[model samples]
Structure formats: structure tokens, C-alpha cells
Target: MKRFPIGILEFLTWTIALTGLFFFARVEGPHAGLCPIANLGLTWCPGCGLGRSIHLFLRGDFLASWEMHPMGSFAVLVIVWRQFELLYLIKKQLKSWQTY
Candidate 1:
């Protein structure tokens, strides 16, 4: 197997970390200081409201999630799929290296 890129691992780490933070916020209620765009004094962001939407979707409130952000559920699904793909690649690489 070819060497796995360090950057890919870094990216995957951040993605997983952010997803964990989202779940934490969902359980702990809204963390007002968490949104970088809002903290930067921006009135709007392309991903504004997505966190709330995802939380709702995770809690089985799909309709409310869609009302908050039309594509929130789909975005979460894609993120999950990407994470799985990354993990699969990492596992395959390790297995091949062990055999060699």
C-alpha cells in the first residue's frame, strides 16, 4: 500500500472533533460562544443554523431540522459517509502494511 498522507489524517481528526462538539452541544444545550461566524461579528454565514438543524435531525426531529436548514440532514449524512470512508482507508492501509 502507498503511504497514507498526514494531511488526510489531520483533516479526519478535525472532522471527527467537530462532530463530537456538535453532539456535546446537542446534549448540553446551545453554546452561545461556539459559532465562529457569529463571534467574528458576521450577520450571516453559509452554514449558519446548520448545527441546530443537525442536532434536531439527530434527535429524530427531521421536519424541524429541515425547517431550520433545508439540507442539514443531507449534509450530516454526507459527513458521516466521508468519515466512514476515511476510516476504511486507514484500516486497509494498516492491514496491507502489516502483511508486507
Candidate 2:
């Protein structure tokens, strides 16, 4: 099978992640995410509520998003910025190729 380029792979991964977060259902009580610390049976993890926080942020619940994780909004901004960066890189690469 042909392999996907790194840029394409990254773009797809981020797209899927954001899309999933957008559709992620709100959960009450404990967060059931794939956090290694939580999986290790620890009571607290710094990154635990990030996904839920992003989900809440996407759904326009800023206060709850902040409550879920202080960096959630910032994380969203970074992720979106990364997406744009990837697109710019891809566009730059295409333009360079056209010059050859």
C-alpha cells in the first residue's frame, strides 16, 4: 500500500481529533478517558480532563470548559493554530514543487 505523506497524515489526525471532540458526549462524574495516570489507578492526573474540557469549549460552555481544565481554551487555540500551520506548510511545499 502507498504511504501517506507526513503533512497529510497530520492534517487527517488533527481533523479527526477535532471532529470527534466536537461530537463527544458530555459525561457526568468521573472522566473515562485514555489517560495513563488514570489507568494506573491514580486519583489525579494533570491531563485527565483535557479532552472533556476541549469538548465543552467546542460546545460553547466556556465556564465549564475552564472548570474542566484551565488550559482547555488555550489548547483549542493551539490545535487550531497547528492546523493552519500544517496547511501553510503544505501550500508552501506545493508552491516550491511547482517552481521545479
**TM-score, each model?**
0.64, 0.82
Candidate 2 lDDT over residue span 1-100, tens digit each: 3333348679889999989988965647754577788899898999878888899999999999999899999999998999999998887777666666
Candidate whose lDDT is highest: 2
Q: Cα-based RMSD of the predictions, in order?
A: 4.1, 3.1
Q: Report the lDDT tens digits of candidate 1 across residue range 1-100.
A: 4686434775567587556646664524455666788889998877777877887777788998898788889977887787777777777767778887
Model 1 bad stretches (over 4 Å) = 1-22, 26-45
- TM-score between model 1 and native: 0.64
Error of 2 at 61 (Å): 0.8
**lDDT, each prediction:** 0.72, 0.84
